[model samples]
Target: MKRPTTGRSRHSGGPNVGRPGFAWALPATIFFALFAIVPLIGVAVMSFTSWSGLGSPEFNGLDNWNKLLGDKVMMQSLWLSALLTLLGVVIQTPLSILLGVWAAGQQKNRAVLSAIYFIPLLLSSAAVSVLWRALLDPNFGIPGQLAGIFGGDGNLLGSQAGAIAVLTFVGAWQFTPLHTLLYQGAARSVPPVLYQAAEIDGAGTMRKFFSITLPQLRNTIVTSGILMVVGGLTTFDTVLILTKGGPGTDTTITPYYMYRKAFQSFDFGVGSAIALVLVVIATAISLIMVRATGYDKMNSAQEGI
Candidate 1:
């Protein structure tokens, strides 16, 4: 009974429907290629060449990697970086969870407490590093003066072990607030009915936290742990400004070591290789964490919620 059959289908009423989908995605695709793909390819290529920032890179097969394997300082730097990451995850996770729970329960002063906790996140890493440096100074700083009262030195940054510990402390101090915020959000999102039912069943605070709160927040804890581990591994600015990888190569993590290799030693090839190695290490650790935490299953369950 129709007068004529047109080329247009009922599912797609307009001629431009399918074409526009691709057109809409083209810009984002191009931008990603330009910024992410291009730079990554450049780094990979540069890793195989010997280049000082000024001239054409000479192709030099696996020389940089071979040298990296034998370089004791580089090995030490990688080990130190891993140790720092481990220390950060172990120390920060529980503290962040506790702070998050405390803040989440504060009905009257929640906003004020959150704002105070967020202050460290606002400051630049360089500024935080400098502030701590002066605070920990042995000769004329407050810590030094306090130590003098007890016949001890406050120059914690002057010894290798002490410097690494201070660096770890500074890292935890600055980043814990972020994880706390994340945990607090996760805690607040738990259904109020669950807590009400727990209270009716005579569950105490500790019991409810362990039975209800922690299970709900498991994914968040894993996410925060992964982020802290990655940040610990790649951190450079704070360590650079505070310790400069000093106290006899004690605090030199991979990122700082990479910077020293590229700029100080004028060896971009080796630096790029180190950068790639760090990327591999981070990726492997993240994959392991995701698998161990059952992150995919948790994500699906959260989505259903």
Candidate 2:
């Protein structure tokens, strides 16, 4: 038997009527639309045209996209970007997590350690590039001087492998500290009682880490991995200042490829297509990673609460 609601108890209105504080949503929505949604739409539209940065864009359908299929340089850039992402994820992720766990355990004198770890991230990428350039200079650079000492004529950043190594070194240096901070935060959030219980159960450090810490930090690891992957894919400034996509395109990533296409070759059509491809790849990979890590389920559980 349904009871009839009185005027004071109920009214004809939407669910949000009772929530008077939801007014903030409107402003956020407007901001997102203006900044994010509008720019994405513009990029999508621009990706289909041939604009010279001055003239009106003429729609060329899928010609730009088709050009991607046969572009050797673009293919090369894609390969390098993929390699960078792979190396970053493989090298940085576990190291960051381990260091983060260690950092969390260091209750005393952590400030000094934190400052040391954060120095790389604190420096600008351009500054790091300039520094590394001087260090790796062929004639009078530290590395070259070291090679001279060793009687081995070696030039870092002169070969393809060297360039890749330099790029990876720069990336890991800047990003690992931030990633460690992420894991450190996550590790600290873990309940102390969990460790006590594990200790009582005779669980060793390795066992506890695998059965407890790793499981608890699954989300942070995924987030850090995604960031590393995205940064690897879109990295341009360091590579630009360091190698200029040179020594025969050894260090060229997709973003650098896009820059060369648009500004160097004056091919806006192809550049936009590459940009769109980058967007799609980044979006798809991020979604896949989030889904794989069960982040959506976690969000859903939080929402249900």
TM-score of each: 0.86, 0.84
Model 2, residue pairs in steric clash: none
Worst 10 residues of 1 by lDDT: 1-10
1-305: candidate 2 lDDT, tens digit per residue: 43333223234364334433545567999999999889777778877888887878899998888888898888999999999889989999988999898888756767579768988888888998898888777788877667746345557777888788888887888889999999999999999999999999999999999999999998898788888888889998898999998789877889999999888988888888888889999899889887877879989897543
Model 2 poorest 10 in a row by lDDT: 1-10
> Any runs in candidate 1 off by more than 4 Å, and if so which?
1-20, 148-151, 285-305
lDDT of 2: 0.84
Score each candidate by Cα lDDT: 0.86, 0.84
By TM-score, the best candidate is 1
